[model samples]
Target: MTLKQQLTDDMKTAMRGGDKHRLGVIRLVLAAIKQREVDERIELDDAQTLAVLEKMLKQRKDSVSQYEAADRQDLADVERAEMTVIEAYLPAKLDDAELDALIAAAIAETGASGPRDMGKVVAAVKEKAAGRADMAVVSGKIKTRLAG
Candidate 1:
């Protein structure tokens, strides 16, 4: 089944199991997906769905940091929980070794020789790493590699 269908199934399972927290997170994901579809006037494929989940995960991460900075452990915990739920649906993350390999390949493929070519390298990496790696981390790696 598609990722969207999996989310719907998980939502039903959460409801049946009386998992309020999981259910709420699943609903939040579905709502975000729906909102994007409505705004774009098109259906989202698995890649687009993953993008939405990633965006939500990033927002939750930011919230967690802000809450922790304010000494609000309870709020931070909630955001962390939501982040965990969202992460469960994302593609497996690339580890340091795999990420490095991917970055090297992207740089080679794009013939990026210096920082000026960073954008080209990044665009290539983003296409290959989408849903499988964090773009921010990938970008940082690209910068470091290009600079040195």
Candidate 2:
């Protein structure tokens, strides 16, 4: 099933199971997806849906960090809980070794000779990694690789 369809199915399951928190998070995801479609006037493919989920994850991460920094452990815990629910829908994260291999492959594929070619290499890696790896970390690694 498509990601959107999966989300809908899970939403129904959550409702049946009386899991209100999970249901709320799933509704938030669906609403975000719908809002994007309405704003862009195009149906989101699985990749686009993943992008929306990634954005939500990023927001949650930021909230968690900010809450922690302000010593609001209670609020941070809520964001962390939401993150757990959100992350359940995402693909497994890439391990460092796998991520390194992907970076090497992307650099080879893009023929990225140096730091100047960072964008092309990063784009290639990002496409292959999809939402599995963090791009900022990948970009930094690529920069270090190309620099050396």
Best by TM-score: 2
TM values, all candidates: 0.96, 0.98
Error of 2 at 131 (Å): 0.8
lDDT of 2 by residue, 1-148 (tens): 9999999999999999999999999999999999999999999999999999999999999999999999999999999999999999899999999999999999899998999999999999989888899999999999999999
Clashing pairs in 2: none
Steric overlap count per candidate: 0, 0
Tens digit of lDDT per residue, candidate 1, span 52-139?
9999999998998899999999999999999999999998988999999999999899898999999999988888888999888898
lDDT at residue 43 of model 1 (Cα atoms): 97
Q: State the lDDT at 9 in candidate 1.
A: 100
Off by over 4 Å in 1: none
